[model samples]
Target: MIGDSGAKSLSEGMTSMHELTHLDLSHNNIGHTGAERLSEVMRSMDGLMFLDLSLNKIGDNGAECLSEGMRSMHGLTHLDLSHINIEDSAAARLSDVMRSMDGLTHLDLSHNNIVDCGAKSLSEVMRSMHGLTHLDLSHNNIGDSGAKSLREGMRSMHGLTHLDISDNKIGDSGAESLSEVMRSMDGLTHLDLSHNNIGDSGA
Candidate 1:
């Protein structure tokens, strides 16, 4: 259980390793305080390209702190924050973080508390990520309105090849909207919409 204290120690030790490119601290039991410590050291990581902090307990506050650290990480290519207990309250702030990550190609936000408003805020930032090719938003609470907003935001993701929005509150209307968007996504090769409420009319 590498908790908050462990994270602090790790951050302290890695302060001189600015050239590091990949970091995976998944399922480490780190919380808000740990995230803050990690944020402090992240400012020096200009070469970082991959980061996975999935399955932790970094809720809204933790997410905000991490976002602060990510402001300068423009070279980041992949970020995974799945099942981190992020809620809608952190979506807008996280969107700001994504602005600096415009070069990102893979993003995973599945199994969180992002509802329509959160998804809307996140999706808007995604519009600027023209290089994005993989996105996962499964097991959330997004509905039709959120789906429509995401569709609008994803209109420019011509290079996108994989998308997942399964196990949400999407009904027929949302499914239809996503289908329309995916139809135009030229490079799209994979889509996951299972466990939703899509009916035959939407399919």
Candidate 2:
């Protein structure tokens, strides 16, 4: 519930907690400036494994700054950036950083404006994240092209067990492609493709 406490407070208080493992700053009004400053402090917290920055007003500038901070966070396992104003360019930058985060298992980027370009960028990097198990990309604009691309990229994620791509404008072709990929994912147990355009044949 620490929504509007600003970045100065976070930098001052969060930097001292070197042993902190999880930090949730969701619903905050923190923008690019605050995010940039907070990112600098987060680089020192080596024990940080989970971070939630959802509902922040962070855009591409903030996302790029955060990516820089995330590069040093090798121990990070779970990350949530949902409802942020991140787009395809920012997602690409984050994807580059994610390649180094081999420990990352869960990621949430829902409720944003990420479209086919963003999904394509994510798919390119997700191929190397073998430890990732849970991923949420719902409420975006990913279409059949993005779904097909993601299906191909996610084939390497053998550890992936949960996935959510609902409300992404996926049609029958996209669902067919995703279904085919799901059949090969032995670890996948949870999948959410509801609210899409898939027909009975694709279903």
Candidate 3:
């Protein structure tokens, strides 16, 4: 792991690369402190389209910093933050920043501590990102209420083709809500709900 200090050093170097389009810092031990510095560099990369920071332990604090950076990267289309210890507050912060990025096509938030509150926040933000083609929120802690909220948001995601919410705490009620929403999402091509608590009635 490169750690926060390493990330800070890399961020300083990142500022000089104006033509960079892809940035992947997965598995680095970056936290809020490093994220804050990286964000400062991200603000200058308006042409950036891909950003991946998976497998790091950047909790809610890092999310806040990244959210602020996201504000300047309008060309970003794919964002991956899986297994970063993100919780409800972090999700809420990221959702607020994502609201303006309608051109974003793929978003991955799998394997985190997100609960119902976080799901609700992501759902609300999903409403405006009609261009989203892939969304992964699997292995979280979302339940019925969260599923219902996400279902409502999915109503407007007519352009989404792949959706994954597997390995969560969702049960029959949540499955039903998702089913209802899927009926209207004509563009949906793939759906993964495995490893959940869905029953025959919901299926």
Candidate 4:
């Protein structure tokens, strides 16, 4: 956990180290300033495969900045931005940038405020990523409509194997929709829908 560390301390003198593949800066208090500065350096770290920035205070502005810098990180396979205060607009921006990340297989955006719009936008983009296998959108406020939209968008993701949408306000209707789609996803091995409103019928 790199929480509370100033941006200058994190990125200061951190020059080119192209071989770096994994970096975890979770719980960091790096807001817009740190995100901006780090993004500038990240542009050159093309070999980065995994990055975790969960629990950071970086909001939409920082997310936008990260999106711009991550455009060149084609090797990125896993990314975590949970609890970063990302909204629909920021999620859209991230989705746009994610189009370039064909190799991305795992993503975690749990605990954010992403609603129907954000989930729909992300689901649309996830269709283009055939390699994506793991996804976590738990603890958000996605309602039944958003869950249905996600079901529609995820229908084409044959490679997806793990999914976690727990604690989202998904009711029986949403669960039914998801269950229907799950029939087609042969690769799906793990699913977590705990803390939802699904009843026995939906199960």
TM-scores for all candidates: the values are 0.97, 0.93, 0.96, 0.92
**Root-mean-square deviation of every model:** 0.9, 1.7, 1.1, 1.8
Off by over 4 Å in 3: none
Global lDDT of each candidate? 0.92, 0.88, 0.90, 0.88
Please, what are the lDDT tens digits per residue for candidate 4 over residues 88-112?
Answer: 9999999999988989999999999
Task: Rank candidates, lDDT, best first.
Answer: 1, 3, 2, 4
Residue 107 CA error for candidate 4 (Å)?
A: 0.5
Q: Model 1: runs farther than 4 Å from truth?
A: none
* Candidate 1 accuracy as lDDT: 0.92
The sequence of per-residue lDDT tens digits that candidate 3 reaches over residues 41-109 is 888888889999999988889888988988978888999999999999999999998887878999999
Q: 1-203 in candidate 2: lDDT tens per residue?
A: 34334685768777778898998888878889888888888888778899999999988899899899888788899999999998999999999988878899999999988888888899998888889999999998899999998988888888889999999899999898888878778988998999989988888
Better structure of 1 and 2 per lDDT? 1
Itemize residue pairs with steric clashes in candidate 2.
Answer: none
**Once superposed on the true structure, which residue ranges of model 2 sit more than 4 Å away at CA?**
1-5
Give me candidate 2's TM-score against the actual structure.
Answer: 0.93
Clashing pairs in 4: none
For model 1, what is the error of residue 56's alpha carbon versus the real structure, in angstroms, after optimal superposition? 0.5
Q: Which tens-of-lDDT digit does each residue in 1-203 have in candidate 1? A: 79999999999999999899999999999999999999999989989999999999999999999999988889999999999999888878989789878889999999999999998998889889999999999998998889988988898899999999999989899888887878888788898999988889988
